[model samples]
Target: MAHQSKRTTLGEIGEHAAIRVIREECPSRNNGDDAAVLNQPAPNTRPVVATDMLVEDRHFRFDWSTPEQVGIKAISQNFADIEAMGARPTAALLALSAPKDTDVEVLRGIARGIQQALEPFSAQLIGGDITGGEKMVLAVTALGQLGGNRKELRLDAARPGQKVVANGRIGWSAAGLALLRKFEEIPEDLRPLVEHHCAPRIETNRGVIARATGATAMTDNSDGLIQDLRLIAERSGVGIDLKSHAIFPDELLCRAGKLTGIDPWEFVLSGGEDHTFLATTSKETPTGFRDIGRVNKNTGLVTVDGLPPRHEAGWVSF
Candidate 1:
């Protein structure tokens, strides 16, 4: 008997094809212009740019997340980097690669998801590329423009006695993952918090607010709180003491003690991917910013309850 070859289309080629087609069709920004012709017409003032790569299995599980969700996450994470630097994102470029046998609509949905995430920020997608690969990988680059002379809140300026503040929620992702793993079903009431774990909102205004408030140092909580704070401590040449009691419950799991069977404090302390900003400033912190710690003169040490930050270690690429 003769064998029949399966039919295929652009979708079968995965995200790579889409990226290649877009790159070929779009103008190149290889000249170092802050604003790509596709992304912005005027020269952006701040002209900040950041890139993040999402690899399959490492960053996300295909079964656990939808294509749209993955796409949105890719965009949101890149934007969080921009916001962390105290800039406003104005445009983005997506580069994708995947297996040849994948569905085409999934790639389309990814693009739609990027558009969806961009819509809320009033940003635009300029251009990108697609290439063939054995796995699914998304590389997103986000560009931001500073409005005027607004300097970025670098991580090197933390000062002694400066209060540390957080702008958004935490531990929701860890809590949500626990629900998905231990409990086969997600409670209807818990859906919102789980969704937050999947996609928690980033504080767009707080970055500027922190900068305006004279923040000495700042960074986003992409990794767990302890680990990220350690970064600030090392960079600023200072020691930090986290007053754990001050952390607020921003996720449903924070309040889901009896039913969720999870320790909310552990998640709040160690849970990552929250994308919230943690900053230090001598002046009064902003209104929504909750003070969680304070900086000291000692260099490169972070502590909780008088001990080195031993709570939950932050994310490690390794």
Candidate 2:
């Protein structure tokens, strides 16, 4: 008789067990309730909510990303959107759609990832649903709290004289994707870039800081610097004049681009998924952020040193 493997599947573990796995990692206040009971914000504060969905082949691939990476990516992206509003992420709701044949360990790994990603912000995974599907689909809804008397940052608030600033890594994810596509075996040096593409780490607290320091407008760089800035410019009736030399490219990204024969500037200006924080500020640039450009009254334009970008601006879902 041949020996049999004992791999546990979603069907074997059932929904309760699956919930146990997630709650074990990040226990909810309303553990067994039909809906999570959350604390109401203080006077004058408002809730900031954002959601992101990741489909199997479209947002990620199992061969390149682990279940943990997928979970982290989903949480980080949604949280970044909340942060863009200059708020502190408080909690999240997760929804998983996967094939019944999916391994229970994979689900547990995803839970662990979500828990770890929320650790820095003191956020919790409050509630969610799990269902069967043809491919793995993860949807994360992140909720945030905007505190203090400062106004919430909006894209339309950017002004003509406000300085453009950025905090956190940019272009690394796009560079990573470029390397991943070109080479069968990624070099050891390039592993960091690949990891960045799989799981980006944004500056979570800068959102609140930007608010306190009087940010005129803000946005996350998930859609590339130029593209996201264009959104601010278009919404605010202003143009952004970026200094060509002001946008710094990391050495690793430059090397990656050189090796792949791709322009590093393209990744800097057009690549998405970095999730860095970008803002227009009236006061001095906040600590942890570097000056990149200035907002102009020209409106509806984003230029690099007075010239339009040669490459495309950013990612388009359609």
Candidate 3:
């Protein structure tokens, strides 16, 4: 409702006012400083950092996604990158750029969304900058700490005999996007898919669990499953074989695909932005992960049920 009120532009309130809004909405441990002062990290641990950028029309559209949703999605993707490396997120720095005429409430909504997204991990917003730009853009940098004796998961550590497993859902976001593009009004049954596209709630704890459980390699499925697997295969000098039957195809995706005249399998193989954790393990699969395949001697290939996917490319930025 505040967003609906008479537009209070960022230019009118000034930069300090905007920063005050962020500070109030997303309070951090450190305040009144040029840079956040973090406590010394745990001994015998390493820091993991990841950064991602989201641009209007390219990553999301104002008509399809709210300011809050944009904020959440941006944070989710960056935090997911940290988790995939077998670490726990500790803090974030958000840099936002938008037209001077943009509504201050919209920016506040974005700050609130960022705070909400980090609540599950007890992470905080450390510091960032805002500037004027032609279109809305958000650059998020997530910082994480890897603790304990467990080795950090790497994409190149996968080896032959290691089992390929996955945590979290796939294809749901792709299905949601499809529905949004094809239908004028989304059906009630497919609302969950649309929600996924707007804001994915990835399981952050799974990364730590996988590392503790002896995961050999891990990566987040921001790109399609096949595309990410190929990265592992190439980096590890191994091949991966995904068992089609092992993948838990969601019923919602199937229904959406049928309605849209698209194959759900395509979405499963090539769709990205699910932020699901995909990993390899020589030991028992982690509690939350489902075994999907295995690593094999290098053939420089990734296959599903011994056959190459119809499409190999996932989300590509050019």
Candidate 4:
């Protein structure tokens, strides 16, 4: 006897069933309104929202990443944009497209991953749409709240002579991807570093703190650091000089890369998806921030020891 697929029309599934699945898998923080509703603006506060898209093949490989990793990465990248604006993330709207043949269980797993990732930050899922596509695509928009008298730092505010600092490690993801692609055996102790490369540690709170502490400008190290820093410089009418030695990486990871004939500086300068905060500040930067460079008045350019940064290729993207 042949078994029937559970594929039923939305009419047969019932609206409540669909809502229940989402509620259980990706609970929204908006208190079950027909639509997620944000609170009335607090006096003198403005809501900030940003969105980004990730297309399969362009952003990730289905073979290498679990569905959960895919969902988390999608959420993490969009939330990072909110952090770059110096605001605290409050909610996310995700529109996911997949082949109609995609398994419901797999889709549920992706939603579960999104829920889990949002738990730490108290961000809620508002609403989103689903449609068919040739390949998987995730579009996420994150909403945030700006607090107090502090304005979120924008790229335009960078000033000459401001110290450049970074609030997270660099290159871990690039190295991890390399090892994964080469299928080389990594030592047991290096697994964590490799995982960090798969999913770069995000420093959202640090970004918000830097903004409150008077950061003049900021951007997340999503594109290679040099490229992203150059964006800030161009937007702000400044040039940036980064001290190569100051790019922090896990020492053991660095040693491992050396043994494998990989240049650590390449990871530091051109690796993307690190999600680290590179910011300009006038005040003594707080702990956890490494002073990596400085800003100068000029057209956009990023340099190391007066030379252009190098890259074997560049970070992955679609």
Encode model 1's per-residue lDDT on 1-318: one tens digit a residue.
Answer: 398666454555644556544434332454123434643435546578899999998887777677777878888888888877777887888777877766666676677677778778877677766667888998999988665565687888888989998887767776776676666678888776667665566656677677777776788788888788888889889999887567645547655544667667767778788787888988998767988888987788887766764466667898
- Residue-level lDDT of model 2, residues 13-35, one tens digit each, is 88888888888987878555788
Q: Put down candidate 3 lDDT per residue, 18-54, tens digits, no spaces.
A: 8999888899867447888888998988889999999
- Sorted by TM-score (best first), the order is 3, 2, 4, 1
Query: How much is 33 displaced in model 3, in angstroms?
Result: 2.1
Model 2 lDDT at residue 256: 96
TM-score of each: 0.84, 0.96, 0.96, 0.87
- Model 3 ranges off by over 4 Å: 1-4
lDDT of 3 at 300: 65
The regions of model 4 sitting more than 4 angstroms off are 1-19, 29-35, 184-187, 252-261, 312-318
Model 2 score (lDDT): 0.88
lDDT-better candidate, 2 vs 4: 2
- Candidate 2 stretches with Cα past 4 Å from truth are 1-5
Q: What is the C-alpha lDDT of each candidate?
A: 0.74, 0.88, 0.88, 0.75
Cα deviation of 96, candidate 4, in Å: 0.6
Between candidates 1 and 2, name the one with more favorable lDDT.
2
Winner on TM-score (1 vs 2) = 2
